[model samples]
Target chain A: MSETTREQIRDVIGAHANLPVDIRELGDAADLFAAGMTSFASVNVMLGLEDTFDVEFPDTMLKRSVFASVDAILEALEALGVALV
Target chain B: MGSEVRAVSAEQVALRDRLIDAGHLIPSGVDGVYGHSAAFEDLREALGTRISAEARTRGATRLTFPPVLPVRQLEATGYLANMPHLAGTVFSFDGDDAAAAVQGTRASAHEDWSEFQAPTGVALMPAACYPVYPALARRGPLPAAGAFIDAGGAWVFRHEPSTDPARRQIFHQHELVRAGTPETVLQWRAQWAQLGLDLLTGLGLEARLDRANDPFFGRRGRLLAANQRAQELKLELLVPIAGPEPTACASFNHHLDHFSSTFAITGAGDDPVHTACLGFGHERIVLALLARHGLDPDRWPAEVQDRLGAPR
Candidate 1:
């Protein structure tokens, strides 16, 4: 994935994930839930990602693993055919 | 959780019919609605008494509530957002006599009369502990030791209708909620879980604790349930009722600042308090007793009768 797409994912997470820690400081593979993100807040993050990417996540992608980390979110978007560049 | 559909097994159907035939449960002709016979009520009350006695020993503040909960309280808890499919909202006809006549005519004709009914200020209580949050929030900040509320046996409603007698639409849940530091709440929940297991086993039923999750709604809810399980937020005491799958007769849930944040329930220095609740399904417990023992409480095992304080 392109750096631009990664930045976008980070931006959405920062806005919607409700994580107490700074998004920039967290690594790509950092666990969001461990960083004080709650299950209710994760829904907001998913909705934000959907809005930013202009794609709807199917029921199959609606899993904790898909939203576990920034890398996982990027992979999900790519699988949904979201072009990075 | 509402998406998956499981067919009702013949064994469940037979057990339900058997209960009805034995006059333990008076059928209301609805799938999950049934009137309890005196024996059933007495057994349920005995179980409730046993639970209440334990709660009293723990210095719990006993509170009784009606079957309906204020709609605003339900909304504040964000229950509907997660489990909309299972929530049962109240509605009433708000109209003049002429409009009432029309509504009555539609009802008599067996047509959809719900259009005449407007949403009420309240909804059927989804859980026993729901009313406790808003009530405690009204009391300002909690004391240093925190709050232990014994929400008495109140009728709670869930919209799921099934032939399985264990899965009732309306049932009495004896729930106890504790709001304090995470340690206090977690310890209280664990204590209750053990007590519940002991009580069930003492009553001659095979019961065990298992990690569990609520039946949250929709795609987002799937992730919520998974996260709940991962964090060990909920646990259920399951017992075999009819079929092979054991039914959850009671549950212990740890709400890490979910309710405290929602209801502004704070401890000393306005710190967000963690909360947890353990609820026992009185009807389901009694049903499990019946399934394990026999229909006649008088003929129950001496040890089981002694445990329940059943008249010999």
Candidate 2:
């Protein structure tokens, strides 16, 4: 993954985190679910990811578990053969 | 038509029983509240099958929407101004002891806190078409004439409470909405009304077309109703549910630029798209069918079963 791609993903995650919490404080492998990422907010994150990557999420990848964490989301994208730009 | 309505068929009884057994039919004790158990789920499943088939046939895209909506969006569409009486609100906690509230141990000093957040996420979407209009508007203009969407939703909140399963607090509504030029939109509405009537008749339910009035708003609402009587925008597919009075199983509404103008939904040519919606209350239709044809799937008329895609 390019350095820029990782930073961009981190930025997207950071921007979505609700007030009183910041995404940048978390490690690269932090658990988003534990950090209070709600199911509804996760959907918004998915939409952001899709728009940023210019790719549509396959129906199978729309489940909550796959997007539970940054690591999980990255893994799902990799499995879908979406190369980090 | 006398009071001698035929007894409910055994098949109808069985379907009701199956729903009860499956935990879909929750008994509200008063026989009104529609959400207790499996009946809601059964109705949704059955209607979903029909909607999917119809959408595929009509080349409409199948879209499932969230039941909750943002209150602000509904406000933007003038929903509150038009139908405040029917609107249900969600209130939130605002008491001083916030921690005790989370544990459900302390009652908030403010009584309203017990209910839910005010301007509740969105007024419980009363109609399936409510959300689609905004979505279309956001996508800019429609292609040339307009577009079609198959919207199927459950747990729609209506304040009315009737003992008949057909009219419950919460029910499933399956609708097809077309937004575009008046000619195309009205034509689609008319066609669907005919198709809906035919579908009901095929199910062995004796249905008739009848003019209706919008459940209009406020002091001027009477005038609105009177005007509606004049224009006849609401038309229903009525089926005899109890003894004499018929229940509306489906309705066709022609909101001539009412919604489009409100939502800024326009056609590709920059013309305001006229909108029309065909609404089917799945539970009501099912109840009417059950009342007309007995409950047994095996004994149900072949034509009715065929229309519903019930397996032989």
Best by lDDT: 1
Worst 10 residues of 1 chain A by lDDT: A1-10
TM-score of 1: 0.95
Candidate 1 backbone collisions, by pair: none
TM-scores for chain B, in order?
0.97, 0.82
Task: Give the least accurate 10-residue stretch of model 1 chain B, judged by summed lDDT.
Answer: B1-10
Number of the top-ranking candidate, with TM-score as the measure: 1
Best by DockQ: 1
lDDT of each: 0.89, 0.68
What tens digits encode model 2's per-residue C-alpha lDDT throughout A17-72? 44146877777677775776743356567767777777777655655566666777
Provide the clashing-pair count of each candidate structure. Answer: 0, 24
lDDT of 2 at B145: 53
Docking class of 2: incorrect
| Per-residue lDDT of candidate 1, residues B1-312 (tens digit) | 534545788788899999999999988988899999888998888888888888999999999889999999898888889989889998989888989999999999999988788999899999999989988989988998999999988999998889988888999999999999888898998889999999999898899999998988877788788878878999999999898899999999999999998888989755569999999999999999999998888888899988897655
